[model samples]
Target: MSAPTSNIADFLRWLETERGLSFAGYPELWRWSTEDLPGFWSAVWGYYGLHHVSDHDEVLADATMPGATWFTGARLNFARQCLAHTTDARPALIAVSETGDPVETSWDRLNEEVAGVAASLREMGVGPGDCVAGYLPNIPQAVVALLATAAVGATWTVCSPDFGTPSVLARLRQARPTVLVAADGYRYAGKEHDRRPHIAEIMDGLPTVRHLVSVDRLYASGAAPDQLPRPDVTRHDWTELADRRARPVFADVPFDHPLWILWSSGTTGVPKGIVHGHGGIVVELLKALGLGVDLRADDRYFFHTSTSWMVWNLMVAGLLHGSTLVLYDGSPTHPDVNGVWRIAERTGATTVGVGAAYLMAAEKDGATPAAERDLTAVRSILQTGSAMPDSTWDWARDRLGPDARLQSICGGTDICSVLAGGSPLLPVRTGRLSGPALGVALASWDAEGRPCVGEQGELVVTAPLPSMPLYFVDDPGRERYTRSYFDVYPGVWRHGDWVTVDADLSVAVAGRSDSTLNRMGVRMGSADLYAVVEGLPRIADSLVIGAELPDGRYYMPLFVVPEEGEPFDDALREEIVGAIRQSLSPRHVPDAVVPVEAVPRTLTGKKLEVPVKRILQGARVSDVSAEGAVTHPDMLAWFARFAARLGSGRS
Candidate 1:
């Protein structure tokens, strides 16, 4: 609950003693972050060894809402910083699957491939400011295409391979990319599903696409033109394109220039395109790597994620610090449930990142990796995508190792960086993010816009920080960006997270403010109940929502997915009620405990509590058009029947 100390001081000492990193103006760097944030960010651009073609005299001249600018007259290349270490001897990428097969690509080889693709793009008349989209998985080739697009100043957009053809078309149609990269098929859970048909359907929807390049993931003999949905769409092989190549050149642009376009999970509506700049992203991520997680040069970083998640973009910052990144493409549990742990052990990963839901799933399966693997090399374990339950923290301490640090981090795609997270200097509390990030003036304000301690409220930032999205692609003059985060507080940024900061300054994330339920008059976050219910041994995961009765009264309805063989009997329900009543108030207790086979989640592994609540109200869920809505839609029908039985008082 004390004020945060200077993180720059700690970063400097760690850099000198532990990381062996040297830089000029160490003291000035500390002052700029705290006193002059604009100067601090400007210094980061130079300190991190970024490539810039132009320089500016003014670091920052405005601090207004939705109009702030950094390094006003500077120009830089995003792809150059990413490919700074390009060489024949250094390994640029190391991709491995759950089956223990490894694929390696050197920096020089990757650069050569990128050059070939860039030359081909020029031949097809794809120039700067054009959009190039990728409907692919997390592979080396995807990274190559992205870099190639950025090298030529073309915007890069991507979606995971799991998305259906309609969903892919909906996004691509909005962005209208000229070139599309896809695969014939991908392997998952030991099955090869053909994506050629899906790709063909996508190309049919995108009439602007001039070229469709397919990677032979299945290793087939020849390309079939009849298999493609659009016969007019020209096809190119991945290897053949690499064979005819040229040297890639970096394009320089303004510091605030657009680099890439990322889409928000269209859970509520059509996904919005978020555009970020090169200088801001590079500097902000470098600060996050050095001061946020305290990443070291020799460290090996691994996160279980797809190309769709922002974590993939965040993890690329590790390369700036000279760390080896371990990429995993297949399911975390392929042939067996222990696949991720096995990879961690073999790779000697120092930092391991996993979604909170995955950790709970492992606990549900009674998975204990302590006896099966050696996790001594792991220094910190990062958990995000949702709030970390208290039971998961206990499992990490007891099962993973006693000495390991469990850091529960919280941030969203809007900023592409964390507003508050774990710090090495801070103590790891039971189920709380360690503390506020350096230079991030984060606070918890109530509905009345009053800052209060020991009270749950909306999380907001008092000042502008680096890495704020430059613009929304569809919005003209930045109207949507202003309405999304800045409209709530005028000048301050209101992050859509419901959280509580204790008197001690320790942070606890409740849930998304947009998803918080109001029962009668009291506001309750979904995470408030999830933390309490997940603490029980009988429950693997639980979703809590407020359901309206015919009499105009609202009651909390709980749906639980029990561990392997556990049932939702009367005794187990009583135990769950007792725990909630003891930890929170009596109002937190659920009116019913309905057992389910699986809880619904988005592609990023976040729970869909609001959509589930709608189903219980006798509302039609099929009318809903949210991106990544319930992976299994049938589960909602089961919940509806259970709700009907509960309403009849038949239990």
Candidate 2:
């Protein structure tokens, strides 16, 4: 087999031969990449052979934050780059489900299906600047639809079938897609869920959608929905688009043209639609997946994720390396704790990525994956979404063998790539990430915006990156985009995570500095909870928080103040959980609900979510907030006492 094209060692050697550049180690190389931004990015483009149809006159046209211009005068398409690595030796996509037979799609067949869908989309008047939405699961059809949308120079966005109608509409309404690709139903945890009613409601809400392409996944099992309730919209079957005879054609769009949209909500209730460009993603993925994770052409990569999470998008990028993608569309712990391990072993996955919580849960469940399952093909394990304890890492390393490289990464949906993550040259450390990613000027800053080391501080990036958002949809004058990252540090990207950078360059992420609730790798805004809970007539107000404990466990609790003449009881708790599960998602349902005399709030009437979360995580009241700044100052003591009762175990 041929060697990988973009690993760290290969890049270093190629740098020496092509540019006469030499560095001692990862740190020196990272410094050069950040300091000489233009030279480094230009080298990446050339090293990856990303110049598809045209050449760029300049690498970095502008270096400003929230408006960085890269690779001007270049023309390329992300789908074209992905298709360039196709080979006849291996399958391009391997789809596995809990109760269904595994299906494999070859490179040639994948190309044909993508071309057919692209042709159909063009015939529907979909072109550049148009949006195509997907309401599907993590299946091969979803992958083909996204690639086809890119092939036609259209922006793609998707939400998993598990999401409720309200949550799905909250995002799709903003994009205003002209075409929607949906699945009639999906199977999860050995059960079939018919989503036709939900899709019909979503379609009713999205008036801009003129076309609906349905993938009948449940038809084989005789559980498909009989008919969709919508008759005004044009309908097409999945087979029609996939079987149409057509040749592959790619649009030569500009470098910064919008490729896809990913949603990341903040303190505000609305979800922000972050748009990434074609050129930025092509180069960034090659660096992040190839160098950071050390992915090779012959390797099989598997990451268990829903279509809603950004990791699903990253997993799709594995095709750029000609690597086989192993996709699972079901619950991770359906039959047993060893489900993920069994899939990895069966698929011969070289790189396995999952949230840290899943491994911790497996360990707690007394699962011996390495002894029971043949995971010898797994060369690396990538973890993200939360901090992993030292004991969890020790347990995983011992069970998986010393040869396995365990990496705890820290990045977000905003960029759809790694900021501080794995490197081939760095050593694995317990409770810490390997280091900052190359081309990312990452640092920990104190309250005064000064760089700090050996102590926890705000995570900030001092330089611009290629994969940053091109713009947020509907964000006129870049107002929302600027206010999201630049308002905190002015010209620097504040990632909202508290981190520590040791002298050796290894980094540790504590948790989110802001009020976002991240439960099992799925991040939801606190405002999303408020929108559901506060709407109830029996609830006067509510505050919800997701806290990561030191023992690798997450505790999410909802505190509510009952309305006048209303009492909080078992019935109310059930109501709250049902509302959250049915409206937002089953993932965001709080672990516990408690009745409170009053909800804590700041003087500005904003809910004190971050302070309450910090208190629950064992911080002092004074350390978290000032008494003068809060409406109910004594509520801090109440939360502190509550933390004391739970103790370190967070029971």
The best candidate by TM-score is 1
The sequence of per-residue lDDT tens digits that candidate 1 reaches over residues 8-32 is 5555664556545444542333334
C-alpha lDDT of candidate 1 relative to the true structure: 0.75
**What's the distance in Å from true for residue 283, model 2?**
0.7
**Model 1 / residue 519 / CA error / Å:** 4.7
| 420-515 per-residue lDDT for model 2 (tens digits) | 888879988887898999999999997789998987778999999999999998999999899989998999999888788998889987666676
Q: Please list the residue runs of candidate 1 whose C-alpha ends up more than 4 Å from where it truly belongs after superposition.
A: 1-35, 51-54, 87-90, 221-223, 519-522, 547-553, 614-623, 627-629, 636-651
Measured by lDDT, the strongest candidate is: 2
**Cα distance off (Å), candidate 2, residue 99:** 1.2
Candidate 1 similarity to native, TM-score: 0.89
